[model samples]
Target: MKLLSRLVIGLVVLIVLAYAAAVGYMYFNQRALQYDPQGPITTLAETTLSGAENVAIPVDGSVVNGWYQAPAPGKPIIVYYKGNSGSFSAEHERYQQFVADGFGFVAFDYRGFPASPGSISQQGILDDAVAVFDWAAQKGFPLVIWGRSIGSGPSTYVASVRDAKALLLETPFLSAVTVAGERYPYLPVALVMQDQFPVNQWILDVAEPVLIAHGTADTVIEVTNGERLYQLVPNKDELWIVPGGNHGDLWARGIWRQAEPFFERAVATP
Candidate 1:
């Protein structure tokens, strides 16, 4: 009986130690999981999209690079925030689409991404976004903030505080904690997750129109998160669920049909 008691105590101690280790690991490494800053890539000018110009934003003592093209006065301006991977050039086609539609477009690399300086943190990205938004807003154009994947966090953050013509989120999660909890049911993500965007919370405060597009087949962020976010919005007509669409390809699956009308409504006619 003595030996059995000792073994039981030892097992309990082992489990406690393991749990402590996991909590420590999560606290330190959560930032890495939140931000994926791929090293620098091609400049905006190199992409060769006509009328594109390189803009510099100073944030946290570092210069973050961005691309901007202003449309005619009174046009809608898309302040686009991209996903985790790839440089700004990866979305050249999308930028072109905005410009071709006669809307001004602005996109930037997060601090640790190529051409941008400084390590990325949740606050740092938000700061960078506000800086860009302020810069664009000064031009006196109506702003529509667009966020995709991880970018949705900052997008929602910005829109909640600042007024926008509209806010668009693609493949967005309810919160980082929610996603981590879903992925690791055994772990305590709610307590340890560092970069919880709390989109559900922020969306409540947003006054402008919101368009949430999520793919039915998205395994990465999952479709349920998008649904939850969509439901929170007062107006249900703005939600777009692309059937048979995955995380990366929802835009290809008739997203533009909704996008065109959303833009039309968001942008005021001169």
Candidate 2:
């Protein structure tokens, strides 16, 4: 009996140590696991769209590089906030569509992306987001801001305080911490994540019309995140949960059909 007890105690000690080591590894490498700036994303050989201009906006001691073109008459400009990875240039064709439809747009690389400089953090990105909106507000076009995936953090933050006419979230999450908890259920991720972008909390404050688009098959952020966020929005416009649509494919599944009309209604002419 004494020998069996000793073996059981030793096994428990080993288990505890292994669990501690796993938690430590995750805590140290959280950012690397979350924000991936080096991965390859879809890109065009070159952007050939007409009338598009390159721009650099200074925000809180950092410069954000991007492309901008003003909309034609009676159209609201689309201020696009992209995902955590890749440059905005990957969406040049979408920009072409925006231009083709007479909608002006500004899409930029967030801080820590290739041309933009600054460390990535929840508050830092939020600060940069508001500054980007302020810069585009100079054009004085009614604004329809949209965010995709991880971009939901800054997009929701901007809508909370800025004068944007509409807010759109694509495959969004309830919050960064909530996502971490989903992916790392074994660990106490909610307590350790450093860059929690409490998007659910921010969504409660958005007054303008808000639209949420999520795929029922989105495995990255999941559809429930969008549905839950939709419930929190004060001026909920529409909840577009596409059937069989996955993350990054909602656009192909006719999201623009929904988004365009939402924009028109949000910024409808009196």
Candidate 3:
């Protein structure tokens, strides 16, 4: 009987130690897991970003680098917040579409990515987002704020605090903690996660029209996040769940069909 008791106690101790180890790893490596800014360091000389001028905006001891292309007269501009992966140089096709539609665009690389050098945190990115919005606001054109993937955090936060004609979220999550929970159901992710980009809560404060697009087959961030955020938006615009679309294919599926019209109607004077 004593031998069995000792065996049971040993198993329990092992389980406890393993859980603690997992928690420690997640806590320490959370930033690394959440951010991947490494990709081709693109230059204006390399891509077909026609009529785009390089822009630099100073914020919090760092300069965020961006590209700005003026729209044709009497058109709105899209202040684009890129996803958590590559530099905005890779967003050429989208920019081309904007140009074709006579819509201007302002896109930038977040700090610690490519030409912009600094550390990234939730508050840090959010602050940069506001600074960028302020810069774009100077152009005197109607604005549409578009956020994709990790960009949703800053977009929702900015939308709550600033006024824009529209807010667009593509392949977004409820929050950083929520994504961690989904990815690691065994771990106490909410307690351990440090970068909690609470898009769900921030979205509740946005007063402008909001359009959320997510892929039904998006494994990076699930479709359910979009569904829940859609319900939370104060001025819900549209929720697009692309059949079998993944994280990066919404544009290929002709999202521009919905987006162009949405932009036109959003800025239309009533």
Candidate 4:
């Protein structure tokens, strides 16, 4: 009986220590764990959109800012959702490509990322996307939602909920839990993750034309995730697997050359 009692005490102590460590880690690294929407985003928003005007849309009681480059009056407006890091500054060149393609382009930084003020969360990002979409609709512009990396989650969610003309995902993951599992297989991510972006579930509900692109050599979030996501969509969606491309270098490596044609075809249809 004494041996069993000692065993029980040891197990209880171990559990307590584990729980405390998890809590401590979450507390101290909360900012990093969550999104830090500072620095580069501000500089990106301030710069002109090359050929279009810069605009700000209010979201979550704060101004969610962006750049608007008008191509033709009646052309479709491309609303871009960037990756987790950096702001519009880092993404200006990419935005210019869409504008030069004769599409009105609007790309913005999420809250806590530069000019915007607010904490970031999975749902918060979706809400912000919706707000931007509404703003575009009000401006009499047709909307195409484009998401890259982490931004894919909100873009997919918004596309599922709204009348998006088309959906574009670049280097997207299947879900947050799937990504966390890949990075930390030991942790119970399914239960611990507070911001779960289940793109697999949401993609099923999206009725618009969808285009998913991923680099074949992507190391950060593998191409498999994007493939899995593309496979899950009920509609016949387009998937582009770039040869010898890394996560962020898809555009730099000329993936856009193929993408621009795909976008032209997709946007032209309806």
Candidate 5:
């Protein structure tokens, strides 16, 4: 009986040690648990286009930084919410492509990244996106929201709450909690995660046209997450699956070729 009691006690001690390790890990890597921003790229805000103008807009009690390029007088404006890593300056090529395609573009950095001030959080980012959209509307420009990877959270959230011409999501995950759960199945992510960024829940309420692109070779968030999001949207939506294309390279693989047609069609409708 004593031997059996000792074995039970040992098991309890082991479980306690494992739990302590998990807590410690979660504390140290909380930023990773939230949004892990890589080291600031030196080329983050450098503009390559001849006519591109750098601009700043206020968001959530802070000045959000971005670049603006006008392609035409009456073209729809594309407000791009970029990924977590790089600043808006690094996305000039994308803006140039859109400008060449006859669309005006605005790409902005979130708070606490580069020139933007204030702390970063899920709700803060969403509020910043809304402020940007409001700024665009005030300028009398129609808006098309583009979200990539982590940017999908605020973009989709704003799209659901506001009126937008269309939405483009690239390599988006369902939610931060879901992704964390998948990555760390042993952790109770639902309870531990501070910023949930629930895109799956918000997409269901978004009525505007949605274009989702995912690459089969994506290892970070997996293509299944994009598929799941596409399936959840209740309104007009299209999912473009790129064979062997990985995350952050959907456009490089000609996925944008398929996407541009859909974008044109959506813009032409009504």
Candidate 6:
């Protein structure tokens, strides 16, 4: 009976140690799982957008690469922050929406992504975004910051810092840690996550006109996160819930048509 008791206690200790090790590993390497700077490159040459000029904005002694199409004078420049997976080149078609709408467009690859070079960090990307905003601001265009998926965090963050004519978010989450925790309820994301892009926390003080478009059928980063984020925006904002639209299909559901009127209201507002 004594030996049996000792064996059971030893087994419990081993399980506890293993669990701790797993948590430690996750905590240290969470950034790798979070940011993918090498997934795939999307080039501007592949798109049908005419006069899309290659742009380089210097930040922290590094250059962030993107494509820029200046709109007609007196129009808003649509600054897009992309999701984690692809580079700016992969986003040319998406930018075409803004171009077709006669809006100036600028979208850059985050540092450590293919065209941009630097280590990826929450603060690092935010710094890059601010630099890009400063560059765009000098071009004398009214600013409109837009973000999709993971990009929404930076979009909200920039809107809080800079004076934007409007802010747009698609399929956004409350925060990276919040989404991770939701997906892995058994894990302690708050304790282990490295970069918490807290969009909800940032948008609390943002007073710009904000538009949040989310899909009700999204299983990844569920629609509830988007709802919570929209509620936290303490500003002139609108939420468009696309019924039966999945994570990546909201654009197909005439999102740009919805956005056109929203942007009109945003830019027209004082």
Q: Whole-model Cα lDDT per candidate?
A: 0.82, 0.86, 0.88, 0.79, 0.81, 0.85
**Candidate number achieving the greatest lDDT relative to the actual structure:** 3
RMSD of each: 1.9, 1.7, 1.2, 3.0, 2.1, 1.4
Residue 198 of model 1, lDDT score: 87
- Please give each candidate's TM-score: 0.92, 0.95, 0.97, 0.87, 0.92, 0.95
lDDT of 3 by residue, 151-254 (tens): 99999899999999999899999997898899999998887787899988898889989999999999999999999989999898899899999999999998
In model 6, what are the clashing residue pairs, if there are any?
A: 42-89, 42-90, 43-89
Best by TM-score: 3
Off by over 4 Å in 4: 1-20, 27-31, 34-36, 41-50
Better of 5 and 6 by TM-score: 6
What tens digits encode model 5's per-residue C-alpha lDDT throughout 1-270?
A: 999999999999999999989877896777665665544643434545667776789865568877776647656888889888857666677777888888888888888676577778777788888988888777676778889999999899989989888898989999978888888788777886778899999998888899899999998888999998898987756888889989878878876686567667767777
Give the backbone clash total of model 4.
6
lDDT for 215 (candidate 2): 89
Model 5 weakest lDDT span, ten residues long: 38-47
Which ten contiguous residues of candidate 6 have the minimum total lDDT?
37-46
lDDT tens readout by residue for model 6, 1-270: 999999999999999999888788778888888876775665666677877888899988789988899986657888889887867677666688788878888889889888888889998889888888889999888888889898898888999999988899989999999989987787788887878998889988788888898988998779998898887878756899988988778878988887777777877877
- Candidate with better lDDT, 5 vs 6: 6
Looking at model 6, residue 163 earns an lDDT score of: 91
Q: Over the stretch 152-203, how does candidate 4's per-residue lDDT look in tens digits?
A: 8989988888887788899999987788778767666676678878999999
**Residue 149 error, candidate 1, Å:** 1.2
* lDDT rank order: 3, 2, 6, 1, 5, 4
Candidate 5: misplaced stretches above 4 Å? 1-4, 41-46
